[model samples]
Target: MNAAAIDTSTPRLRDFPYRLRDNVRFGDLDPNQHVNNAVYATYFETGRVTLMKDPQYGLMLPGFAWIMVRLDMHFRAELRWPGQIELGLGVARFGRTSVTCDQVVFSEGRCIASAQAVMVLIDEETRKPAPLTAELISALQPWLRRGVKGTRPDLA
Candidate 1:
C-alpha cells in the first residue's frame, strides 16, 4: 500500500504524546518480503522501552519490574523494508498494579498497525503485584489519554 493512501486524521494518532522513529531492517522481513506478524510485537516493545526508559517519563523503579500481562494487536497493513517507521504511544488506562498502553506503528505517514498491552508493576524480589507509587503515577499522568477510564479503585 502506498503511504499516501493512509489517513492520519484519527484522534488516537493526534493524542499520542510519545513517539519513536525506527527503521525496517532486512532481518525484520520474512519469506513474503514484508515484516513478519511477530515483528510487530517487537516494534511495540521498542516503543515501550523508549517511553519507559526516558529520564523524564520513565517508569522503571528500583527493586521493581514490569510484566506484560496481555497484548491485542491489529495489523492494518503490511510493512515493507528499507523504510522508516514512526511509533506512537499513550497510556489508555491505569490500575493499582497495571497499566494499559496503546501504540500505533506508522510508515510513510501511514498507520500500519496498532496494539494495546497491559503491563503490571511487580516487586522484583517477591514477584507480586505492587501498588503504583505517587511519583510513578504523577509521571504517568501526562501521558494518559483523555476519556479513557482508569484505575480499579478497589485494587488501588
Candidate 2:
C-alpha cells in the first residue's frame, strides 16, 4: 500500500499480543537526522525474538531452528532519535512448517512502521524444513490474529 493509504493515526499495538520497547540511539540516525530505515528491521527482529523465546509462547523448539524467509515493511513516518519505539507483534498466519508474523512500530503513540515476516521451522540436523509440532501449534493459537485461519491467511 502507498504511504497515503496507511492509517498512521491508529495505534495498532493493541492488535498485537507481544510488545518490545526500545529507544532510538544517536548511532541509529542518519545524516538526515532521522532513524535510519534499516534500523526499523532490527527493531522488528527484537520483537520477533522476544516472542519466540517466551516460555509462554513455546515458539522455539529443541533441535529445531527458525529462519526468516520473507519480510515486508512499510514506513509511514520518519522516526527521530532520542525517542522510544514500541514494537508489537502477533501471528498473522500459520502453516505446516512456517508462521507469518505481523508487526508494527509505534513512537509517541503513532504508528511509524508496519511489517510482516514469514519464518520457517527447520531441522538442525538436516537443515531442512520441518513440520510444526502439535504442542507448538497449540501454544501459538492464542496469539493468532482474529479472523486469520491457519495454513496461510491472505495477507493482502
Candidate 3:
C-alpha cells in the first residue's frame, strides 16, 4: 500500500526472476526535470512480462494466457532523466487461478519504487479464470519467501 513501507533493507530479494532496464530519455522528464510518475508503470510492465515469459515459470501454458487483473505502484524516490533502473521481480503469491508479484525498481542499489501486481490465469478460448497446473506451481515455489510457504499452496 505505502511504497515507503517496503523493507528496502532486504528488498524482498529473490534472484529477481526477471530484470528490465530502461534509460531515462529527455522525453521522460517533466518540466521539473524528474521522471514523470506515469512512466514508472511502463517499467513495471516490462518486469511483469519478463516474469511471465521466463523459462523458469511461464504463466501461460499450452492453452492459457495469464492476464493482469490489478496493480499498485508506490514510488518512494524520484528518478531523473538519463538514469537507468533495474526492475526486480519475484512471486509473492500463487493461487489456484491467480498470482501476485512484488516488483521493485532500483538504481545504484537504491530502491526508487516498488509495485505489486495480481494476474488471473485465463483459458485462451474461454477467457475465464483457469486453474494453474501442478508443474507450473512447483516451478514457482522456490521464489516464495519461507514464511509465506503453504499460504497459497492451493495452486499446487
Cα misplacement distance, residue 90 of candidate 1 (Å)? 0.5
lDDT of 3 by residue, 34-130 (tens): 9888888888888878767876565558888878888888888889878787888777787778888888888877788888888888898998888
Deviating ranges (above 4 Å) for candidate 3: 1-17, 55-57, 145-147, 151-156
Q: List TM-scores for all candidates, in order.
A: 0.86, 0.86, 0.80
* Model 2: per-residue Cα lDDT over 78-120, one tens digit each: 9887899898988888777888888899998989999889999
Model 1 residue runs over 4 Å out of place are 1-11, 146-156
- What's each prediction's clash count? 0, 0, 0
Model 2: weakest 10-residue lDDT segment is: 2-11
Please report, in order, the local distance difference test score of every candidate based on alpha carbons. Answer: 0.83, 0.83, 0.76
Give me the candidate number with maximum lDDT. Answer: 2
lDDT of 1: 0.83
Clashing pairs in 3: none
Best of the two (1, 3) by TM-score: 1
Which tens-of-lDDT digit does each residue in 94-149 have in candidate 1?
A: 77788888889998877899888899999999999998887787788777765555
Model 3 scores worst on lDDT over the 10 consecutive residues at 6-15
lDDT of 3 at 49: 83
